[model samples]
Every structure is written in C-alpha cells, then in structure tokens.
Target: MKLIDITNNHPKLVNEQLSNTDAQMVKVYSLGQTTVIYTIAPTHKDLVIINPKRPIRDNEIDYVLQRTIKAPLQSLEVTHVGNFVEITQSLKKKRPTFVPRFS
Candidate 1:
C-alpha cells in the first residue's frame, strides 16, 4: 500500500468547491491590521466579494485601493489578476487617467 504525507500543507483557505461533503466549520483569518474580513470564494469561484461592515463611499476608491494594495500591481498587468482580457478592458474603460490624492 502507498500513502502520501500532507503535513506541510496548510489548510488556511476554505475551498468549498473541493471540500468533501462532510466538513463544516472553518476558521477565518484575522491577522490583518485593517480588521477587515475576507471570505475567500471556493476554488470554482471567480471573486472574493467584500461586504464591508461599515458604510463606504464610492469616492473613496483611491483611498480604499491604496490601503488594500500596499504596492503598485503594475507587474500583474501582464499576468495574474490582469491576465483576464475582459476585466482589463473593463477597468481601462472605468478607470480615470488621473487619480487625486487625499490628505
């Protein structure tokens, strides 16, 4: 008989699409400084929808983006999240050329 070792793998995410029909409760990671919650969608899911605990203004896009992403994601323009052509096109259309800074 042959067996495999899955000890080093960390089950930090909730993969609903891949879960067996038996598992139920799961842990939520709260190590971030923002005190925000991130409910990761399952493996088959395409988005990590955020329903902020408090009200947020649409004009706060820049502030929210800056706080959410510590560094520029320029490198990902050709890969990763930007790899989706349709999404890139949509962002290009909705995004403004100049982004105003807030105090």
Candidate 2:
C-alpha cells in the first residue's frame, strides 16, 4: 500500500504524528528505483503518517530496503526507471549471518 511520503526532512512532526496515534515507525527505506517505504510497528490501529516536508521522489532516494518485518508495509514509488539491474546490483551484498539468542 502507498505510504505517506514522510522522508526525514522534519523529524519532530513525524514523531508527533506517530506518538499521537500511538504508532511507531520501525524503519524508513527505499524498496526500488522510486518506491520509498515506511515500515510501522504493530499498534492498536492503522498508522497515519505526517506528509513529507520536502520532495522525496528525487535523486536522494538511494533506493533499496528488502529486509523482513512483521507488520503492515507502505510504499511510494517514482515509477520512471525501466532497468533495475544497477539498483539491484548496488544493494546486493553478503550480510554476515548472525542469529540472536535470548538468555
């Protein structure tokens, strides 16, 4: 689903919006060429995010966020790129395999 494009221009407003709604922003990253995503933590209700303070569909997207999470995911895309080979290649890195354990 499309997320309210609240990129990190104004943190205070975003915090207030999330706090007032009792929602927490878990992460903010790009999904692909144009798609910026905002992943939210589980809460009593759906999230209502602050509008982006500035333009997010620009070159600053640095697009790529394909981790796993357990909650509703929202996205916004620029939808102009035809080739994602470079984008995929750039984000492709071997991550250290670390499994966490609790005592």
Top lDDT hit = 2
TM-score of 1: 0.19
Q: Please list the Cα RMSD from the true structure of every candidate, rounded to 1 decimal place.
A: 18.6, 12.8
Query: Where in model 1 is the C-alpha error above 4 Å?
Result: 1-61, 77-103
Instruction: Return the TM-score for candidate 2, rounded to 2 decimals.
Output: 0.27
Q: What tens digits encode model 2's per-residue C-alpha lDDT throughout 34-58?
A: 3343434443222121223433332
Per-residue lDDT over 1-103 for candidate 1, one digit per residue giving the tens place of the 0 to 100 score: 1112221242544455228522333322221221122222222112121223533223232233344323343422211222111001112224547988999
TM-scores for all candidates: the values are 0.19, 0.27
Distance from true location, Cα of 102 in model 1, Å: 58
What local lDDT score does residue 98 receive in model 1, on the 0 to 100 scale? 97
